[model samples]
Every structure is written in C-alpha cells, then in structure tokens.
Target: MITTLLVANRGEIARRIFRTARAMGLATVAVYSDADADAPHVREADQAVRLGPAAARESYLNVEAVLAAARATGADAIHPGYGFLSENAAFAEVVTAEGLTWVGPPPAAIRAMGLKDAAKALMIAAGVPVTPGYHGESQDPAHLAREAGSIGYPILIKAVAGGGGKGMRKVERPADFTEALGAAKREAAAAFGDDRVLLETYVARPRHIEVQVFGDAHGQVVHLFERDCSLQRRHQKVIEEAPAPGMSDEVRQAVCAAAVRAARAVDYVGAGTVEFIADASAGLRADRIWFMEMNTRLQVEHPVTEAVTGQDLVEWQLRVAGGEPLPLTQDEITLNGWAMEARLYAENPAAGFLPSIGELEHFVLPESVRVDTGVEAGGAVSPHYDPMIAKLIAHGPSRRVAAHRLAAACAQVQVWPVRTNAGFLARCLEDADFLQGEVDTGFIAARLDALAGALAPSDQVLAAAAQGLLSQTPVPAAEPQGPWSALTGFRINGPRQGQVRLYRDGQAVTAPLVDGPLSADVLLNQAGAIVVFEAGEAFAFTGSPPQAITGEGPAGDGVVIAPMPGKVVAVAVSAGDKVLKGQTLVTLEAMKMEHALTAAFEGVVETISVAAGDQVSEGVVLARLTPSA
Candidate 1:
C-alpha cells in the first residue's frame, strides 16, 4: 500500500489529489515552482517541496527534479496531476524504475498514445474507428499542401503531438492552406518542440465526446461513460458534461465499448481518457464517431464525471497502482443525474481571449457548487503557467437544471483585480443553442460577437454600482478635499451631483451620481437611460479615472507593451516592413500559449524590438511600428 504520495504537479490538480490522499490517510506532498511558492496547493498539502525555477521546463517539466523531490521527501508514490510531465513516458518509467509507485497508467501505455499520429496508427491496428486523414511522417511543406488539396477544403492541420488546440488550424478554403500550415507549424514548434503535423478532413458540426477509462493490474478495464466537450474555444475545451447531452443509448454503449477496447489494447492501467469526434450533425451514430486522441492522465474536467458517478477517481488510481483488481464491473457501474463543468480562466474575452495576469484581490465563488481553484485571494496570476483560475461544477437531476445552476454559480463569483471569462461563461449557459443541446466545436466562434456583447454591464450590475456609491460617505459638504472631491464641488443644499467614472469589462462609463441616502439616478452612456436606484453598493473601479469626464486623449505615439513576462515566438515583419491597420506584427508565447501583438494602425516597422526566443517582461517593447510617413 502507498503510505505517502508526492504529486508531481501544481495548482488545482495537486490540491485535488491531496484531498483524496489525505482522506485516505496517506501523507500528501506537493511540488511547486518559484511562482507557485504561495499557491493554494502547496498550503493544502502535508509537505511541500520546491522543484526549481518558475518556468515549467525548469520546474514541473524537470522529471529528474520531481523524482528527486520524491526521494528526498521519502514519498512511496508519485501522482502526476495532469499537464507538465504527467503524460511524459520517461517520467513514469523513472518513477517505477526508482521503486516508487506511479499513480497513473504504465509508461508503455503513455508512450503508445503520447503522439497523436502514432496513437492513431495503434488505434487502427486495434480495430478502432479512425478519422480519414493524412497521418504520414512527411514534413515537407509542399507535400502537406498537396495532401491538404487531396483531402479537399475544410481540412484540419493538427500537430502530431498537439493537445489543447495549440498547433491546430482549420482551413476552410484551399487558398488559406499554406498560411494556416505555417501558423500551425510555428505554434506546434513553440508548444510541443515538434513541428510534425497531420491533416484531417474537417467534420461539419462535430461533437467532441471523450470516455474516462480505468484499468487494474488484474487485467480488467471499465469506462465511466462519456463526457460531451463539444463547447470549446480554439480547440480547447471550455465546458464539459457527463452522459453527453443528446446522446443515444446505442451510441453511448458503442463509444464506451470502443474506449474500453482502446485501453485494453494498450494494457492501460489507472486513469486515461479516449477522445472521439462524433458527427452530431446527423445525430449520434456509432458509424459517425472517429477516434481523435487519448489523454494519458487525469483530465481537467474530471469533476463532472465524479459528480455524476459518485466516484473518487484518485482513490481508484491509488488502488490500481497497488496492484488491486478493478473496483467495479462494467455492469455494476452506473451514472446518475447530470453534471457540468466550466473552466474559469483569467482571460479577456473581448481581447482575443488573451490571458490576463495580475493579483487576485477578491476571489469569491458560490458555495452551492464545487469549485476547484489553485489560486487564492492575494495570489498573483504569474505569466509562467496556464491562466486558469478555477473549474466550477454543478450537478442536478437534469441537464437544463445543472447548466442553469452552474451559470448562476459562475455569475455570483466575485473575482476582482484580474479580468476573467466568468461573464462569457454565464452568457453561454443562458444561450438558447447551448440550453437546447445544439452545440459543436464552432459554437463559441459562431456566437463570438453575441457572447462578447452579453458580457456588457447589465441592469443588476448598475444596481450594484448604485449600492456601492450610496454606501460611500461623500466628503464633508463643508470642504473640498482630494482631486475626486474637488472635481465634484461642495454643495450646501440638495444632493451634490458629481460625475464618477467606472470601468468594467475593459470599457468605461460615466455614472452621474446624485448624492442621496436612497434613490440615486445613474445615466448609462450606452444605454442612454437614467436608472433609478433604491439602494446599492459602490463598485470599486481601478486604474485611471474614467475617460468620460476626464477628457483624456489617447496616447498617440505611445507603444502598447506586454503586461506580463513572456517569450517572443513570431516576428511577422522586418524593421522596414509596412503594415496595415490592425495587422499582426508579432506573436508572443507566454504561459504555454501564444498571444498576438497587432498594429494599432497602418504603419511602417521602425524598430523590431524583440526576436523569437527572447524572454520579455512587463512593458518590454516588442516592436515599434511607426505611422505611415
């Protein structure tokens, strides 16, 4: 039996594993990087070890360091809690070779499915359904172009080792294939250290369904049904649910059976995920499902599966690692009710989903739902890791109720000081298509504008603002004090009217405040209506004063700089290159993702500030694109 376990990862996943280990009476150890020194997972564990530097490559990805920590801490086992080196075959091999229990699938299974191209080949040999595409080993650009042409338009260029949408592009037209390939290659090289890519015929309106499979050393494997992860952004899953909505009983059984077969073929032990792309355009059908890829570790959206199945997957992993037999038979296991999970990220939805980094001043969520979070209030969202804040999950008797409850829980979350995708998630849940189970991978892209628009301040938000203002005791009517008070001018009689600027969702609005105990009037600029508030709280606005009454002009010659530390991955233009308005000039890779820095207007590249592979910090000038002469 494993008495002590070291989790070779950080954030919510580490915390999650620690929760189960502690409950099972096992000592839990946490490994953290410099940036995550004060992270929640570190505090939650019985013992914590510093791996190395803040960068993932230096810290979590350093398999030797993680194994060394396990040895130093005398941990009997190591549980790689997803991402980083979790799926790295070498890491698993080293752990078992060191006489330590590896609380995941065998290294052989990981190696078998580590690369998508190789995994597809293995699946084909295992008699599993595979997508029709070019999974060849050729890397020649022209060869790929020809393959794309033969595959016809609307093809997907995917990295052989890619996951999380990186190094993947959808080409809707033949003319855009080359450019898309180049972009995908750049991303793939930056992300996976491999530029090898594959091509697949893009399925129209496909639903992403993945099965959770577990195995034991006793030669038994079982699946925990399926989860619908069709709601995605840029190929990364945003929302997931168990017992996929709109799934037919026949198709569900077939998918589960296929997943079990795939696991059995690899002799998979512990937890693994088999993802498949289903052609839901014609409804769920066994013939329409095609194997996508396999994730060899626990998934980020596993909470929904746990909620519906009432199983502690981590405990099962530990049992399986101890050479135990399968916990339950396929016929004995059953899923109840419905569950949903929404990934809450620190990102600006309107700003091309660019990751946001800053201090989390006030991070509060509802207690009605399960929230798996890594950071705490006062923790900084460093630019060294994924910008995910938490995963919120809700379970109910029905899918509709679960979605509605989950949305409500997300909306009630109070996270300030850093922008998040909370508003956008709430809007998606309330969307008619999502509510009716009519969704696919292109759901978010097709409804991007509407979702972004829905993030605007609603009447309830304005009421909260009113309550915030009234609760504030204005400066004495006798004397004008600071800049804010002086600008308003003191009044002896009647309610003193002052214009206060407010910022929300990256937009500014001026609220005309009528200094009253109750019943204050606020005129919203965009709504063009005066809202009467009975009682409200003042919403604290940060950054510079509102632009409405400040008459502040735009910084014409000022350069927009990177707000956090990162690496420059792409320089689209040379020093003398000319660019049009809003044209991309450089793409920065930070926190394991890419962010494009585009031109503010038509300009000539005056100075190429940074090159690919250069590490940058906040305010670093990546480029200087001067206005046209």
Candidate 2:
C-alpha cells in the first residue's frame, strides 16, 4: 500500500492530488519553487520541500532536485501532476528504479506516446484512424519541404514532442512555408530539445475532441466519453465541454472505441487522453475524425470530465498505481449531465492576451460554481510559470444552462491589482454563436474585436464602486472630535474633491470624488458618472464613461508607450527612421507570448528608449515617435 505520496508538481494540480490522497488516508507532500514558498499548495501539504529558484528549469524541471525532494521527505510514491515532467518517461523510470511507486501510466507507455511521429505510427499499426501526414524520421529540411508540398498547401508543421501548441505552425500558403517551418523548428528545439517535425494536412474549422481512457493491471480499459476543446486561442484551450454539442451516437462510439484501442496498443496502465481533430464543417461523422495526439498525463480541463462523470480521476490513478484491477466496467460508468470549464487567466483581453503579473488584491468568486484555483488572495502571479488564476466549472442538466451559469459566475467575480480574462470569458459564454454551440478553433479569432469590445467597464461596475464608497459611514458633515476624523476637513458651501485613482485594463484613471450624503459625482475632466445612492448603500449610474479617455492620457509630447511589463523582442526602427501610421515598432515578449507595439501615427523615430533584450515595466517608454513635420 502507498502510505505517503509526494507530488512532483506545483499549484492547482498538486493541491488537487493532495486533496484526493488525503481523503484516502494517505500522507501528502508538496514541492515548491522559490517564488512559491508561501503558496496555498505548499501550506496545504502535510510536509513541504524547496526545490530551487523561481525559474522552472532550475526547479520543477530539474529531475534530480525532484527525486531528492521525494527522498528527503521519505515519500513512498511520486505523483507527477500534469505539466512539469508528468509525461517524462525518464522521470517515471527513475522513480520506479528508486523503489518508489509511480502514480501514472507505465514508463513504456509514456515512451511509446512521447513523440507525436512515433505515436502516429504506433496508432496506425494498432488499426486506429490516423491523420494523413508525414510522420517519418526524416529531418532533412528540403525533403520535409517536398513532403509538405506533396501533402498540399496549408500544411501544419508540428513538433514530434510538442504539446500545448508550443511547436506548431499553420502555413496557409507555400510562399510562407519556409519561414513558418524555421520558426516552428526553433520553438520546438527550445521547448522540447527535439527539432524534428511532421507535416499534416490542415483541416479548416476543426473541432478538437478527445476521449478520457483509463486502464489497469487487469487488462481492462474504459473510456469516459469525450470533451470538445474547440474554443481555442493560439492553439491553447480556453473553454472545454463534455459530450460534444453536435456529436452523433455513431461518431461518439467510434471515437471512444478508437481511444481504447490506442491505449491498449501501448499496454497502458493509467489515465490517458486520446485527442482527435474532427472536420466539423461537415458535421460529426466517423470518417471525418482523425487522431491528432495522445496526452500521456491528466489534462488541465479534467475537472469538467469529473463533474459530468461523477468520478475522482486522481483516486483512480492512485488505485491503479497500487496494482489494483479496474473497479468499474464500461456499463457501470455513465455521464449524468453537461459540463463546461472556462480557464480564468491573469491576462489583458484587449492587449493581445498578454499575461498579467501582480498580487491578487481582492479575488472573490461566486459560490454557485466549482473553482479550482492555485493562487489565493495576496498571492503573486510571477512570470516564472503559467499565469492561470483558476478554472471555473459549471454543471447542469443541459449545455446551454451550464454555459450560462459559468458565465454568470465568472462575471460576478471581483479581482483587482491584476487584469484578468474574467470579463472576456463572460462575454464569450454570453455570445450568441457560442451559446448556440457553433464553436470551432477559429471562434475566438473570428470574433476577437467584439470580445475585446465587451470588456469595457459597465455601468454596474461604476455603481459597485459608488456603493463601496457609500458603505463607509457618511464622512462627518462637520469635523469630528477624534484623531481619525482629523483627516476629514469640512467647509460650508465650499466644494472639496478627493482624488482616487483606479486601474482598469492596464490604464489608471483618477476620479475626482464629490462627496454628498445621498449621491456622489466622480468626474475626470469631461468624462464622469453621477452615482445616486439608494437603499442605504446601493447605487445607480446614469451614463457611460467616455470612450476617448480609455487609453493612455496625453504624455505632454507625441509618444505611445508600452502599457504593461514585458521583454522587448523587436525594435523595428532606429533613431531618425521614418514610419507610417500603425507601423510595427517593437515586439514585446511577455508571459511566454509575443505582442507587437505599433505606432499610433505617421512619425519618425526620434529616440529609441529600449533595445531588444531590455526588460520593461508598465508605462515604460520603449520608443518615442515624433509626428511628421
């Protein structure tokens, strides 16, 4: 029996595993990085160990450090929660060799599905439906290019060892193939240490569907239906749902059967996911589904699967690791309801979704839905790891009801100090197309402008602010006789303004507070809101804030600036270089993503404030462009 288990990962997954382990009367241990010393997961564990510095490579990715941590904690087993090294076959091998129970699939299974190319070949041999692509061992650039041409234009160059869209590129035309290939190769090499890539025919309007399959030492495998992860941005899933909206009974059976076959092909002995890309433009058809890749570990969106299936996957993982046979049969397992999960990220929706980093001042979510969060109030969102704040999941009798409930929960959340995707996610759930289940990979991309536009602060927000202010005991009409009251100055018939600045969407606005008993008017130049207090502290707003003042205020001279913290990746112009309006100026790499800072008007580069390698903070002057004379 596994008495003590050490999770070799951090954040929500670690906490999630610990929750299940503890419930099963197993001791739990947590490993944290320098930045996560006081993290919630670290505090929740029975014991905690420090791995190393904040950088993932020095901490979570260091195999030796993790092994040492497990050993030092006297942990009898190691559970590699998804992400850091969960699918690393070598890590699993080391754990078992060291006489530690590995709470995951066998290392051989991981090795078989570790690389996409090899996995595709194995799946084909197992009689599973594989996509038409070049999954060979050829690394010759010219030969690969020729293969891509033969496959046809608009081929997808994907790294064999890639996941999470890191080493993937969609080349729409032959003219752009070379550059896309080079970029994908470079990214693949950096991320996976393997530069080999494969080309596949690009499917337009593809719906990403995957089956959750589990196996045990008893040679039994059962699938938990399917999840539709079609709503994506930059190949990263933003929303996921179970029992795909438009799936037919025949296609669902085929997908589930194929997933089980793929798992059986590798002698799998734990939880795994078999992903498929379906051509949804023609609706759900068995012939239209093709295998994409298999995820060797639990997925981030597993909560939705659990909610709908009413199962704890972590417990199953632990049980399988303990050499137990499959406890449940296919007929015994059943899906009860529709479930949806939305990833709430600390990011700016209007600013190309750049990851936002800061302390979570006030993080409050409604109790109507289940929220699995890694960070808590006052927790810092560092740049060292992914900036996901939480995963909000909702379950209902129907998909539409679940989606709507999840959206309402997200909008009701009040988070400050860091910009979040809550507003944007709420808008997406309320979107007509999304509500109708007409979703695809291009959903977000096609409706980005409308989504961003919906992030504008609503009148309800202004009313909330007013209510917050009104809740405070009415500032004495006349100066009170206490030290706390000294700060409140009173003058008859003389108006005094208290300036309060609040940040929204990366821009700070100073609202002049005009104090009154029943009402307060917050004015900022011409854009102001008259907040009327009702029912003691409630407030009602009259008009919307001006749109022109939403962006950065005048900087005394003609210059736009980088509005958030990031690293400069490109400097498109030198001093005295002439540029056109909306010309690309500098590309800032932040939160492991790239964003281009463009010129606001036709101008000349008067002063280059930063270089390519410089790290910048919010409101930093990156480059000054002088308007044309």
Candidate 3:
C-alpha cells in the first residue's frame, strides 16, 4: 500500500496527480527548482522539497535530486506525470531498484518504445501495421538517401529518440534531402542526445489518432478508445478531441485491438498511448491507419479521454502501481460524449507565435469549463519552461456542441501583460471547416493567417479604453489633440465629452471619453496602462505615445529582438547581408524548443549584436537592419 506519493514533474500535471493521490488518502509531495519556489504545485503539495537551481539539468532532470526529495519526504511511490523523466527507463529502474514503487510501465516497456526504429520493428513483430519507412541502423547519408528514394519523393526524416515536433523534417525533393537530414540530426542531438534518424513515407492528408490503453501486472490490458489530435501548428498539437471525428466503428476496433496487442507484446503496465497516423483521403478506414509510436506515459491530453469515457485514469494508474488488477474490463468501458481540450500558451500568435514570459497580474479562466492551470493571478511565467498557461476542456453531447462550448470558454479567458494563444484557439475552434470535421494535420498551418490575425480594437473598445484613461487622469481643458491633452488641466465641471488619443502597439487612435464608469472589459494595470479585453486578448494603450522615429515609425522597429531568454544556436546572417522580409537570421533554443528570429522587413543587416552559443535575455536586440540601398 502506498501511503505517500511524490509527483516527479511540475505544472498542471503534478497538481493533477496530487489531486488523485489526495482522494485516495495518500500524502503528496512536490519537488520544485529555485524558479518554482512559489509555484502553485509546490504550495498545493502536502510536503515540498527544493531540488536545485532553475536549470532543468540541475533540478527536475537530476535523478539524484529527485530520489533525494522522495527520500526526504518519505514518499513510497513516484508518479512522473508526463514530460521531463516520465518516459525515462533508467529513472524507472532506479526508483524500483531503491524499493520504491514506480507508478508507470516496466522499464523494459519504456525501452521497447523509446526509439522510433526499435518500436517500429517491435510493432511489426506484434502484427500491427506500420507506415512504410526505413528503420535500419545505418547513419550513412548516402544509405538514407537511397532509402528515401525507395520510399519515393516527399519523405519524412524523424529522430528515432524524439517526440513533439522537434528533430523532424519533411523533404519534398531529392535535392533538399541532405540539408533537411542534417538539420533534423542536429536538433535530434540537442533534444534527445541522439542524432540517429528514421525515414517514413509522408502521408498525403494525415490525421493524428492515438489510443489510450492501460495494462496491469496481471496480464490485463484494455483501451479507452481514441482521440483526434489533428489540429496542430508547427507540428505541435494545439487542440485534441475524443472519438476522432469521421472514425467508423470498424476503424476504432482495429486500432484499439492493435494498441492492446502492442502493449501485451512489451508487457506494458499502467497508462500508455498508442499513436497512429491515418491517411484521411478516404475518411478514416481501418486499412489506411498505420501505427506511429507508443507513449510510455500519461499524455497531456488525457483529460479528453477521461471525459469521454467517464473514468479516472489516474485512479487506474495508482491501483495498477499498487499491484491491483485492471479496474474495468474492455467490454465495460464505453465512450459517452464528445470532448475537446485547447492548450492556452503564453504566446502572441500575431507576432510569429513568439513565446511571452512575464507576471500574470490578472488571470481569470472561464468557470464554464474544466480549467487545469499551474499559475494564478500573481504568478509569473518564467522563460525556463514550456509557455502553456492553461488547458480548457469542454464536453457535450455532440462534437459541434463541444467545439462551441470550448470556443466560448477560450474567448472568455482573461489574462494581461503575458500574451496567450486563447484568442487564436477560439478562432480555430469556431472555424467552419473545423466545425464540419474536415480537418487534417495541416489544418492550423493553412488557416493560421485568418485565425491568428491581430485583434484590432473596435471603435467601442477604443472608446472604452479612452474613458478608462480619462477617468484615471483628470480631463484636459484645452488643445484637445495636444500631447498632454489627455493628462493636463483638470475639468471637473466641464462637458463630459472629451477626446483623447491613445497609442496601442505603436498605432495611434483617438476616441471621445464619456462620463460614468469604465466598461467591464476595460482595466487599469499597476503601471497605469489602460488595457482593453476582447475575445480573450488584452490590448494595452497609453495616452503618451513614443516619438515615431524608430524603424517603421508608429509600429516599433526594424531591429530583430529575442522573444525570450535563450541560447543562440546559429547566426544565419552577418552584417551587411541583404535579406528579404521573413528570412531566418538567427535561431535560438529556449524552453527545450527552437525559435528562429527572422527579418522584420526587407533590409540590409546593419549590425549583429549576438553570436552563436551566447545567452540572451528577453527584448535584447539580436540584429539591426537598415533599409536596402
């Protein structure tokens, strides 16, 4: 019997596991780094221990520190709630070797599905169909080139030890194969410490479908249906739904059966996911869906599966880890309703989806949906981790209703200073094609322009903001359009109608201020900045605008700046290089992901401020550009 459980991860996932552990009458412990001292998960745990500094290697990823924390807290069980070391086989081995219960699959199972090449071979031997690709142990570029030719043009180079969108690239022609392979290998080495790659035939119209399966030490394994995660941007999943739209009964049965078989072949235990890539040209046929890979841990989108199936998967994991039999047989598991989850990231979609990190001065998620978040009103989003703010999940009787509710909830998100992808997610959920279930893996990329467009402040919203600013600062008496017209000479008895000009995102707009209180959507931050909320987006405006001499005047500058603190991986351009707008100039790695800073305008590089491997801070100018001669 497990009396104390320690979650070896952070953020919302750790809190989620603690909730389940509490329900089972078990003490919960949380381990946090220096950067997470005041984090919600740390405060929520029954006992918390300090790991180390902010860097993951010195903290979360340090096996010794994690084990020491567990020892100090007297935790008999460890639940790695995805990411970090959740799928690390060696970590699992160490935990069990120390006489502590590992709330996950056997280490052998993790190793079996750890590398893409080995997992593909294992799945083939388990009678599960896999995508046509090369899974051999050859690093020769010429050999992989030959294999790519055999697979035909438009092949996908995937890092054998990678997940998410990193260490992956698509080659459309033979000429681009070498470069793409090298790039993929470099990223693979950086992310997974393995530069080995596997090739696959790129599915023409692909849909991502994965089955949630659970197994026990008693040789019992059952699947909890499937989730469709076709909506993605830059190969990262943004939204996921249960009971994949357009999935027929036959297809679900075939995939789930294969998933169970795959688990049995590896003697898997606890929560695992079997992912498949389906060619949607024919609308989700059993024969067209091919095995992708298996996740040897709980997934980020598990809430959707739990909602649709009406099961507490964490309870199942705890029971299985305690040497219990499967909670329910496959026949008893039933899919009830349609559910969807949207990952709200701290990023500005209008600004190349650049990650934003700052204090969450005022954060409010909709009460209408199930919100899983790690930060609260005063918490800050650090640059040392993933930028996801929260996850909003909604369930309904049908897919359309679920989408509607989810979209509404996303639009209702209230966050300031730190930008969020909520507005972008809401637009995606309300897209007509998305509503009709006519989506594929490329759905988000195709509609990114229409969905991520900047939220322009309407006339009413602008007026409300002006009113808010006027109410704070006494109304001016003369020179209605002067620089201090909105701030000088108080007029307590004059006509309430006063015009004030405010600048937002470097664009100047004038609106008439009225009497009475400011609108509900208008807010005043600590710095006295007027912020207007619309469709889950916060637009800050100021009465005093900066001089319009920088870059494109009234719209910021032509200097390329780092969005967050990161290590510069490469400098693609030097001083005096004539570059086109949107050309990649520098690439940096931060939060375990890569970001390529591009030229903001067609110009000649005037100066390079940073070099390769140099660490930079947020808002630091990386390179300066002047108009082309």
Which candidate ranks first by lDDT, i.e. highest?
A: 3
Q: What does the lDDT read for residue 446 in candidate 1? A: 97
- Each candidate: how many clashes? 7, 0, 0
Task: Go through the candidates in order and give each one's C-alpha lDDT.
Answer: 0.81, 0.81, 0.89
Candidate structures ordered by TM-score, highest first: 3, 1, 2
lDDT of 3 by residue, 243-263 (tens): 999988988899899999999
Clashing pairs in model 3, backbone N/Cα/C closer than 3 A: none
C-alpha RMSD in Å of predicted model 1 compared with the true structure: 5.4
Question: In model 3, what lDDT does residue 334 have?
Answer: 99
lDDT string, candidate 2, 73-159, tens digits = 899999999888999999999999999999999999998998999999999999898889898888888898899989998899998
> Where does candidate 1 have its weakest 10-residue lDDT segment?
529-538
> Which window of 10 residues has the lowest lDDT sum in candidate 2?
533-542
- By TM-score, is 2 or 3 better? 3
Per-model TM against the reference: 0.89, 0.84, 0.93
Predicted structure 2, TM vs. truth: 0.84
Candidate that would win on TM-score: 3
Off by over 4 Å in 2: 463-589, 596-629
lDDT of 3 at 411: 86
Candidate 1 deviant stretches above 4 angstroms: 454-456, 470-560, 627-629
